[model samples]
Target chain A: MKLDLQTELCRRLNITYPVIQAGMAGGPTTAEMVAGVSNAGGLGKLGAAYMVPDAIRDTVRAIRRLTDRPFGVNLFTVDMTDDLSRVREVQRMLDPLREELGIAHGKEDLRTPNWFAEQFQVLLEEEVPVISTAFGVLPDDAMREAKAAGRTVMTMVTTVEEAKLAEEKGADVLVAQGSDAGGHRGTFDITKHPYGANIGTFSLVPQIVDNVRVPVVAAGGVMDGRGLVAALALGAQGVQLGTRFLTSAESGAHPAYKKALLESTEEDTVITKAFSGRPARGIRNAFIDHVENSGVAPLPFPSQNTATGDIRKEAAAQNDPRYLSLWAGQATRLLTDGDRAEEIVKEIIAQAQELLK
Target chain B: MKLDLQTELCRRLNITYPVIQAGMAGGPTTAEMVAGVSNAGGLGKLGAAYMVPDAIRDTVRAIRRLTDRPFGVNLFTVDMTDDLSRVREVQRMLDPLREELGIAHGKEDLRTPNWFAEQFQVLLEEEVPVISTAFGVLPDDAMREAKAAGRTVMTMVTTVEEAKLAEEKGADVLVAQGSDAGGHRGTFDITKHPYGANIGTFSLVPQIVDNVRVPVVAAGGVMDGRGLVAALALGAQGVQLGTRFLTSAESGAHPAYKKALLESTEEDTVITKAFSGRPARGIRNAFIDHVENSGVAPLPFPSQNTATGDIRKEAAAQNDPRYLSLWAGQATRLLTDGDRAEEIVKEIIAQAQELLK
Candidate 1:
């Protein structure tokens, strides 16, 4: 019953199993969750894109203390130069929701500088073992620095072209993010692929693996051992799980967000640009419906992301699931209640071992 | 080096291999193509949805002459009702394309009665071994007639709810169609899901398998041995392919249409309701671009389907692919040139056997 699921992924990433906890940005991936996954024989990752340098350093140190096992910090190699053309209009649009959530209206400044440099610096200073990115591939110099520091560099891509480009740009691994992935899509060109390339995991993974010399990790809609085995069968060296860990006991997701994820079905999620000018999959709620039905195009990327921040945070604070993003993949029906990250990893490995033969 | 790849699907469908050539409607599924696939030890199905009862009877006789192996005929259990509200506007919109194709501007009738009753009657008279339906499940009486005649009934579904409904309605087998599938999506409720349920094969197949008692056949974006093996890994008893066979030598697809399939990439195809009011996946064409950019809702389902019929047929006659539907899945890069159906089937089995161990 013990199926050896190890592949080039293990040797390359120094992990025991081929499972990688997705760097889910926001708050879903906490230090305890990452450490739990790493200690359970999978690669644990900090969703550090939103965290400041000090917070990221503290979280990495926290994870290190919990376990010396290999862990990663995920950042967004994003273009911070946001287009402000629609910011005032979108901000005005979100004010009503902010008021309803008992948050300030028109009180926050929309323009803010990104901290990617400081965040990258903290990772280098902390000597993080693995660094991954979303939104775009790490720059050439960043790739070189990470490789020099003995850290593996991975980036998520939604299309085969993006995968090849990232590989050419010196990425160590490619994560093929299928349309079924929760949260934001990893498509590189927001202009060319406004809705991201909608390739499914079954179709996207093998094509990406075939084109790139670097190992490919399958992501999106994957929830269990069956998914891991299927990803391997599609020629991926490993599988990256996003929504699966969002409901784990060790996850940092709010109670309402976790409850919504546990109750929703596969049909509930849709790729909407209302929450973040870039499209992300989440359970449809009053906030998304109102924004979409208003027929106003949301401000591009970080602008729209910034516009909705106050309302989302307040919704979480008030335990109102309807106003929260409630990001989850299509496999939400498969989610169970209160399992820790370690237990989930072991269950996946054991189930995958049972299904392999 | 040979591998034993047969599953319960082989026994249930009474075939040597679990590959089911998709019953692509329109002109692709020729009698010769079906015979070639059946002769190669897989099930071949006739795309009889657009064909008349006589044509269906003739195709079955022709397939019987070429190979005594089991073959099936696919029919549409569709609602023939028309919503003509937008027909005139859409017809006017398509007139320019029709004129360019050297066809009359308004020569087609938008209202047409469906031949489901006659089609079902012909299948029973012809004693077809296998019968399948798309768009919707077979009517309860039709299911009874098919089962009573010792024929197996198959239906395609795009969501878990539809799969369970079809099983409860008495479909002997269910083909779980993923969003990556070309041609029309197999979503049962067009009202609730205007865009069709967009779950990927990797997620849809396993979920349907777990929820339904009947065997599930994974469809969409599946192209070769690796797709076949991957579908099996996800617990599907078999796999169905549509776009893969469109380029096969024995297929009845127009030469220009076949050429487009060979040249297009994954990003080239998108789901659009332009060709039909109901959403279907096809390569992006100038016709689709004009319709979508115009901001006019396509006349619902068969009305839009009918209004565009003349333009489509004339484009085919003129050997112009730009105006044709050009249905293709995301795995267009996997397509090759002019292999006969039998050769393709054998190649897939041989390649899959090599990968199984």
Candidate 2:
């Protein structure tokens, strides 16, 4: 028997299934991946946080070229400004890593772009079907414009307070991202939670459900049909998969990074701010070890991310995973090699239907 | 109207329901709470890790007097011995908390008892129907003795390797504890995980379930029927709750501790080793702040636990929540003020039945 697993959020997003391929930043999320998920009935998304406006527009156009199904674009809404008085100290912290990776950097060079505003403008101009923002929600005018353009807005929140905040900001859907999630945690404020928000999905999904009226999609550690059904049982309307798509056929992840995810265990991942100033869960390697063992804290988001970009790029070019930031969740063991997004989505739905039966 | 949710493990436990009141150490679990859960068709347990042998026997008798249903007694399987070479430094580190709590400590006076042997003997002598061990499993001889005496042996494991180890060591049931659980995490060996076992429930349960052959009981962050149903959907045969029972009518927790839990948010609690020299999840207090800010690594398990014993007792005696170890899970906000174990169990089962229907 086919289960009626489509939730109200599915209707709102105009998707046949209540599964979301999370808008993971940088590599991993590709136009092909997003289009494939959308074609397979689940919502596909482009992780466009670090992308330039031009790239965002290109990806949106490319996804449109592949599928007419509804898809989404994710952006980072947090400001990039920071007090760089301690920039030299943080740069010094990454000196050893840079030397080992053969990246030339003598000055305090980092990218602090006015990208968020430009990115928001591009998202609106692209007339995207779904706009998902991480870290925080879009501003009022931009948000109103997106709503005015008849686009669905999704916000990632780690706590009930953030959920309430996102709902108050007129978000159409709340993605309750758990600590088990791969990549950067979407904690709204870092001053209050310097340790990073570590709420598990099992506790987080229901609490967010009880506190907010907006439909929720459970993110983090959701790789299979069991997670899908479990999220449904916890009252989440859908499951947002991040690492699940990392090894998919359409993922743009580095070969070494994808191999690391495929070989890792549940306990192999750690949440650290070594790569980015903000806390993110990823496979532990030499880079994380050096920063953590030395007791030198990374500069706040974008700063640390900027400082480490060259080394990560060099490491990827050399296919050395030890120096690369292999962003992955705790459920890496549940992942397989090179399954297409259609197979991934269909397997989850089929497994869920079997379990529901 | 009812769900036939009973699994093979439930039958082996001689219970009609699949809920197991976690054998929480120290205070939360009581005879009445155990009896209430057992009477209501779930397994209840006594947290007798800190109690003497006579106390364990007395509590078993007390629980038996209250209900004829099956009950369990819990004991610590981990050794109390640690390299006390740094015990003095740890004692020195805790001087401020001791002074503030009005504890009179002159020298290295800490309790190191041979309790495991005595406790296990008492459980076997009293013929406990179910025996649950934490930290590690019982010794081979004790396992043989417990099995020969017809007792169901359950072991708490935080990782997949530990789950397989526990099963190999004759664990009839495995309590797959997530990092979201309150109190001390039951990592088999802390040498590998100096940061404590932190696999989230959503990721931990299914991974452990897929690896082990024995019946698995999902532990940590399970507060209500939603959690129960979710655990079931995740492939766990049963659910074990710790903090869910802390605010129960029959709970032996201090009034101030209960009040602190009632007033706390999910983010308010943190996992710190300041209290017990072992990583435990609890509502953050001033004592934790002092230890954390001072950057003092706690002495190993029993040493740190012993060093801070007087301060915790005095804090409890004085009804000060600030100085006490307010052990709780991440689902603190979901808890009510005062509900009996029976109500807690019935409501969870009822809600689960509704969801299943």
Candidate 3:
């Protein structure tokens, strides 16, 4: 009995395989990876987080040029905490380190580009098939708009409480971000709440399945076929893989970044905020090393991000490998040398089918 | 309706809950924390991972002086990969960084003292009631000797395969070290293994209970009475907590280490090898930050560890927070100001009773 990964995934996503090329921030989350996955009977997701409205529009257009297949867009829906005291405190503390890194350190205009609503409007205009958000639940109005526009809305949540919250806010699917997940957590309270468990897909998937009515998408550290079968057996409607795709030929990550991903093992990846003040899993490197060792404090999200952006960019440009952000998950070691999205899709589907039998 | 944590623990250990304060690796696994938890009718454990045979003897004796009650000692077993080539490669790779950290290079002895066998000899001589090994199962001779001497033997395993292996090796009890666990995983094949799952108390306890005939003790990211009750509800005979007790006043983690624990939120902790080459969860800090970014290849187990031992010791001695190995778990943020182990234990029991009803 071969598992119809595509059919099962489509059944769950209301699209094709319970496979999704996860949305990644920065460049690796390319139209090729997304469209390739989608074309191969899986969902490909474009990360629209931190993108300007124009960049998002152009990216959507670019994906459309490549494939007529369905794809999703992801954004950070953080409820901006009005308090700037902590942000200020963090900035004041990290100023010297920024100077040491030879990056200009002054008050970054700490303004969130009200790009989420604008991006949503653009996404609706483009008529993308799916939309997802991390950090918090999307507003009921936004959820209503997306659904009204005939798009499915998925939200990221780590805990059962957040799952319920997303559902209440009208999430069509729940992306359960485990602690082992790479990138920013879709957690609502990054500071106050602790990520609950080193919950493996086996344990967390079933519990979330038991708790929620919506289709559950198991994200975080899922790299290959065994993991995919395990997720489905544990009752996940689909498996969303981020780190695995980052090193694929279709990805647009810097050559150095992709190389680091190839080099990483299960032990090599770690969850750290030395890059962005927000917690994210990535390959251990020089930037992370310097920040973790420096007695200086880290600036809050965006500020700390903006402060170090130059150094990170320089490191990547120089192929320094050390300072570059190597965002990845625990399953990084499993990412082997591979081609673009379609081959990966076929490989995973075939192996997953084998495992189910 | 009250869940008897002690009774459940006793059933799992086939001993008394008043019997175990889980063995902690660093100084935080102190006589006070051990004696107090043991005194309160739960088993207290002395972390003997970093200790030499003589140190283990002295610490066991110290705990004996503090409490006439029965307690357990814990050790790491079988991390020495018999693959000499791989071991040599790892040591050779570590040479540069060792020199950078101002440590002697090319000691090349590569043999970490196999304290497990020696410690077993001391335990037999001293006649401790219970003994356990984390990471992997003890050798046949050690298990046989301990059991033959009327001592109870336990082994920690992170996966079912490992549990079965332990059972095959004649382990009397199994401690299920879930992925949420704070310390080094007792996984035998750290190189090729997938950390099974979030496998928290809820998911792990039941599965381990069903699969193995021996009693199961759940460990990892567990805190408070709610967690204890939940574990018991999932069929855990008992629960072992490291992070929760580490924050108690009875703990000997450096003041800075304790402070980091006290100040931690779920976001504050991440699994990293900035301390030991092995992945362990701890309060996020500069040591982790520096190493994470430096791209300096971390020395593998025992070697990577030996290289950093001086810096860690020096940092701890000088109370320089930057270099301290602040090993802790996600539960660090939940720890309140109270330091009394007895009070914490009583409160956990009391809270569990309240929730159980």
Candidate 4:
């Protein structure tokens, strides 16, 4: 018997499978990966948070060029202002590491550009089917525009309060991002200290489901079929995976970073704000340890993120994962090496379908 | 059609239902509650960690008097030493609250009595069918002794490393406790900072199941049938609940604490080290807020816990929950009021069984 694996989210998103490839920022998720997952019957998402407006359009076009299957775009609603003084202090702290990595360190350009509006504009112009916002809530006008364009809007929330707020703000779906999730936390308030509302996926999902009428998507630390079935049992309409796809052939992660993830255990990952001012779960390396133990607090958001970009780039070029931000979930040990995104999607859905049956 | 709800843990624990009511300390879990659950064909655990050896033996006998079904005893393997100076500081910090509650303030006794050996002795003498250890790993000799006595030994672990260690140490079962769990964390090292391996139930259970050969019991924020099914779907053999049972008729929790739980939301809970020197998840109140924002660090575990004992007592006596610990999981909002432990067990089993079918 072919079990009815289609969830309400599947019907609403016009996808065959109730699975989503997470829109992981800082590489990993690429147009090819997004298209691969979508083509494999799951909803794929383009991690276009770091891209300029033109790049976002290009990526959307690129994904469309590959697959006509519906795909989504993810953006970070980050505050683009930078505190130069704090950035300079962070740079001074990074001076030693920069020299070691053979990177030039001078007056770091700390200005953060306002890219969210432009990115959203690009998303609208491209007639994207889905728009996922993280790090902050999407503005009311933008959300209205997306809906007007016949796009489904989803927002990532770390707490039940955020879920309720997202629902109130007319989010078509809620991505309950657990603390064990890879990459930057999708907390709406960047100014407030994170980890205050670090509810895990199991606890976060059901509560969000209960609070919101919209379909809930469970994220963070989900790796395989068991996790997918568990999320559905917990009342989530679907499961969004990031780390599981980080090793996919279609992922844009550095080879060294993927290698590190393959070699890592749950203990190898730590929630650190040293790489970015915001807390994110990543593989623990010398870079993370040095910054953590350095006693200097990182400047908020974009400033700290921008300051570390060069170091991360250099480390990637050198194939040294030690200095790279190897963003991964606690389920890194469950991830297999060199899997194709399409195969991963098919396997996960097939396995979960078997289990559900 | 009747769904087969039998799991490996159900068979191993000799229970008809794969559910374990949490052994919450400082009230809530009681001998009657434990007996009630056990009588309903699920395993129940007496929270005897705070009790003396005689009290533990008495409680075990008391449960036996109510139900002939097998039950378990829970103990904390805590380090029984305190820094008097730090205790004094904590006591001084609590002075204002004590004064507000019209309680006497004086030199607080900071001595932490060694209770594990006595408690374990009681368990062995009583020939308790199951023994659950938290806070620290069960000593090798005690574990061996338990097995010799034909007592199934289980240890609570918050991380995969700890789960592996527990298996290596011959723990018959592994209780994968997540960060959202109520009361004190079950971390092995009291000296080590808490929340270091703060994996959530959804993320923690599957990984622990993958690492351990023993039956894994998922705990932390699991409240009802959906949570139970979710646990099983995630590869857990059973589910353990804390807050859900806190409102049971058989629970020993103060009426005010129960009321607070009934009125609480997921946002109302916060993980704070104020009540106990160790990190614990509890309902947020004026006391928690005051202590958290007070800038004075709490004394180590038992000492800090002991220092706040009087205040908690007074708060309960006054029917004021604001000053009480009000320990609860993040899923407190999902809890319903005035249910019997047996009914809770039966209802959860029935609901999950229906869902599975």
Candidate 5:
């Protein structure tokens, strides 16, 4: 009944059952979950999305304190139009929201911080074994550095076209993100594509595997072993998941947030851009209801994200469910409370093994 | 560029090209679409779900007049619970709406007519080639008689457990329904086993294929040839789609309905029990919004179905938009108006052929 997912995934990743905890930047992913899963024979990921260089260093050190197992740090190698006019347009859109949130309009410092450089440096300094990215493929320099350090480089892609692009960009593995995947779609061109043909893992994985020579890491609504087995059957070398691990005891999600996920039905989740200015699947609640009803055009990418940052932080501090960004996959309802990550992983593998024959 | 989907699907179905048109019991699935697809070398289905025995007979005969090709008729084989108490309970939930709609009371005679008997008798008289059922499997006597008469039998299942059950009950073929499948889920016990996990075609097809000796047909969200190719990769013998053909010029879908489906995004389609008592995916519109926002408890199955039958009829008659049941799958957005059924069949096959390598 043992599925040997580590062995299968390791062999595919050139690692052990093709299991990797997805790098969720905002929450659910924690040092403990990463360390524990990695220690138990699957890869764990550190979400260094919001981390500054120093924080990334400290977090890597923190994870190193617990286990010697290999873990990864996820980055956002976004390629925005370097046109300053576009950046200013985004800045102008945020001015009103800043005033509404009780902040002054003119702070003289209009420039955004260079968080990407510091974070990447920290990963290099820590000699992390793996590095993953979203939005776009990692820069050539980063790929070169990661390769020099003998680290695995993974990239998330929503379509096979994107998969080929990532492979061309020197990605070691392709994380084929299905439409059912929670969090932001790691599409290379959202503007031209406009999110058509939301191929699920079952549809997307095989196509990516067939199109690209690189090993495919399936991501999206994979909650258990049955899903993992299906991914493998579809030609994925490994499976990466987020929501399934979010409700585990080691996850950093709020108690209310985790409880809401466990109690949700499949109907309760919807894909919305209300929270992070990016399309993500989560449990539908008051905030989503407002977004659906309000019809407010969300600003582009990091700007809308930055503008909502204060609101999200305040909502979390106040334990206000309406303002919290509940980023989760379609299988949010399947996540159980107080469950050990190891038990969940083992159960998935065992159940899949039961059906394999 | 040319895909011989007909030949391929035919090969897979153990019939001619593997295309199966929906048995849409509503407005969209016309005799023309059915006959056209069938004549073009694919299976056409008559949606006899909402029809009485006489109507079903007429529709079947009408289809036969148009084409000599083998076609199937679909029916609802749901087990009606023998209690009228629930009807009253459901009426109580709709009592307030009755007043708003200017009806004295929300009262309708509870009836589960022997439509199956009537329809089956017609098929027997006409010697139809295939008969499929949704919601649940047919009775043993019916299946036995259908097989005895040399008709192929197919049933829809959402899980591997259901696949095993269908095979046990003399099902000739299994149509694995994923969560992305538009319309009512074909679950035998909806209250007991809520079909939440989207065991998509890629995943469900292989699992069912592995578990049973019977051929498997993949359903739900299959829009293009890529989907067909992916399904075959997962061991499905063929694929059945409804939404893909619903928008074709040959279909009888209302102008508004077809237009709405054409304009929809994947995000615009949602699964809700607000229309029928059961969960079905459709375009998000005013009617869905009203029902979702309404605090009324839905009646179960037939009772709730009857309670809203008047509103749906009136809505369609008035072209009111707020009361019509816009049944469609999650891939509704991909459907373009003026799509030729023959071209669609060809496109799917062509895509699959290219992907096969």
Candidate 6:
């Protein structure tokens, strides 16, 4: 059997394969992992959402030092809202957990850092090759600046409406993130509930591809070569995988978190707003269940996310995945133990080639 | 353009194309449409969930008269429960709409018809080549009888657990219906909330395929050849489509319903339990919004389904889809007007051929 796997995405990105290592926030996507994937002939993206300007520049420089291959940086465009009462309620709910974990209660005057602008400025200054935006649309000026700096702009969207808007606002690529995707949904409105637009990647990619002329990249629940080929068949030019790489040797995820993912089944993951106000897919644990059953509405994004930072940190330090956000897609079951980022890229491409043949 | 589109599903079902015209309940899938698709080299399925034993036998014979190609019959295996008070509540809520539509309020002793057993018997007696069970697993006895009669059994599942259970119960194939799939979800426990398992076809198919050795058939949000090829790449042996064929000339959908689907976009559909207690995807209309916003809980399956029957009838009689349940998948935007079932099968194959090449 002869199969044509080279897509427009590969041509535009100048990559050997249509697979992209997802830029997972809060650490799994490390500079080493990004460079490893890119060096192995697939595009890799640095998860720069939680990084400060200096950190972003350092990480980009580190990736450059590792490999001169084309890579991308992902940032979050979040709307900051102040709702102290809700934040306080969440803090109250987490009081017991904090006590149990021996962590200090988050301060009442807790503030979320707005680092997106600084990160964007760093990307331009560093002349990043590609940029991917999640949580919401990239600001027009930022998008323009990136283009001016010879960067490719890709906007992540959970719905076709957002895909159209991103295209209209000059997106070179659309990352159609499905509900099964790990991490926060790329729904444009941070204030709107994320679960309302629950279109899966299989359904989302084709519709987005049909509605937009730009190349579409399928994300969420994609774990292997079959997934990459499947996305291409759905009219997508490429696929972005996150969970499969969470356990990669170069990934920054805690060993316990990686172990939990490896031992888990597809049904183990749930979409919850516990770790963050926005819905995200993660392995279900005590913390998620507690927050859901607590009857306390979570504070809006960034606030709730910030409030839980201490808990997650302590959980990671203790090597306990229960209180930590084990962000992984529904396809976590497909992940294999001991696969390096470079090996993962090569294995996926090789398997896809054999299947296509 | 040459494409080897023959999949395991096609070989197992002995069909020329790896496509199955979805057995959409509440009309749209007519005997003529089923036969047309079968004659056109794709497996066509009769939506026999609402038919009595005699009607089922007659429809099977009617299809046999139209085409000798292999086809399938779909039935709902729902566990019915009686809750008169809840039924009355739905009736009371719809009283105003009933009067507005010049429809009579449902009778006090309104009871759901129990015809599944009789329908199964008809299927066995009629020697239906393929049997597809929705809503629940096919009983062991039924599965045995179907297999004894040389009938292939396909179970529809919304989750991987259900898929595993169905496979253990002797399912020859699995139809992995994603959340974006139109019509009632095939969740086994009718009492369990349907929307809780929000897996999309893209996400659901591969996971289910990974869990079960049986060939998986991808359903929901698939509208054309690209979708068919995509499902295959996801490890699905074939694809089942619903909304795409809603406007086929041979489809039983009302002209207004067909028009609504054709004019609609992907965002026009909503998964709501307003029409039936079980959540189903359909084009948003006045009825859905009214029932959803009315703050009244719908009665359980079969009861609420029966209570709203009159309003839907009246609405269809008036050619008003606002009141009628215009069931369609999220891929309604891909539907075109006036294509015949044969043309649809041919077009899908042709388009897929070009793309695969």
Measured with C-alpha atoms, the lDDT of residue A103 in candidate 1 is 73
lDDT of 5 at B95: 53
Using DockQ as the yardstick, the better of models 1 and 3 is 1
lDDT of 5 by residue, A125-214 (tens): 898888899888888897888888888888999766788899998898888887777667687766754432355665567657777888
Best candidate per DockQ, number? 2
Order by DockQ, highest first? 2, 4, 1, 6, 5, 3
What are the candidates' individual DockQ scores?
A: 0.50, 0.56, 0.04, 0.51, 0.07, 0.47
Question: What pairs collide in candidate 4?
Answer: none
Question: On residues A1-357, what C-alpha lDDT tens digit does candidate 3 reach at each position?
Answer: 222355344764665678888788787888778889988888899988878888888999989998887889998886433334456555555556456556666464565445777887888898888998888877778888888887888888776667778887888889877766777777677665432334443335555665789988888756666556545544567788887787788888898888888876445666677776677777888677777777655655655676566677766667778778888776554676657788888888777666444
Worst 10 residues of 2 chain B by lDDT: B1-10
lDDT of each: 0.87, 0.88, 0.70, 0.84, 0.70, 0.84
Candidate 6 docking class: acceptable
Q: Model 6, B1-357: lDDT tens per residue? A: 212588777889999998898888777788899999999999999998887779889889999999999999999988766566876667788888888888777676788888888999998888899999898788878888888888899899988889999999999999998877887878887444455366767778888988899999999878888888778878888889888888999989999888888887766778888887888888889999889989998887778887888888889899988898988787776788888999999999987787676
Candidate 3, residue A278: Cα displacement in angstroms equals 1.1
For candidate 4, write residues B1-357 as lDDT tens digits: 112369878889899898998787765778889999999999999888888889888888899999888788888876767767766667777899999999998456656777888889989999899899888678889988999888999889988889999899899988999877887768887454464357778888988998889999999889888888888878888988888998999889999999999998766777788887888888889999889888899877777877888899999999998899988887887888889999999999877876787
Worst window of 10 by summed lDDT in candidate 1 chain B: B1-10
After superposition, candidate 6 runs with Cα above 4 Å error:
A1-3, A190-196, B1-3, B190-193
The DockQ of predicted model 5 stands at 0.07
lDDT of 3: 0.70
lDDT of 6 at B148: 84
When 2 and 6 are scored with DockQ, the better candidate is 2
Please give the TM-score of chain B in predicted model 1. 0.97
What is the C-alpha lDDT profile of model 1 across A146-198, one tens digit per residue? 88888899999988899989999888989998888888878888787788788
Report the lDDT of model 3 for residue A22: 78
Candidate 1: tens digits of C-alpha lDDT, residues B1-357: 112368887898889999999998898999999999999999999999888888888988999999988888888888878888666777777777877777787643567668889989999999988899898899989999898889999999988899999999999899999888888978888888888899988888888998999989999888888888778877788899989999999989999999999988888888899997889999999999988987778888777887888788888888999899998988888887899999999998987777775
Model 3 lDDT per residue over B1-357, tens place? 223455534754444442245687767788778888878767888888778778878888888998877788887875644223344554455445445455565444555555566777887887778888877777777778888898878888765667788888888888877676676767776575433233333334454665788877777755666456545544557778887887688787788777777765544566776666777766667777777776664666655676566677766766677667777655553566656887777777776656444
Off by over 4 Å in 4: A1-4, A191-193, B1-4, B190-193
Alpha-carbon shift of residue A17 in model 1 (angstroms):
0.8
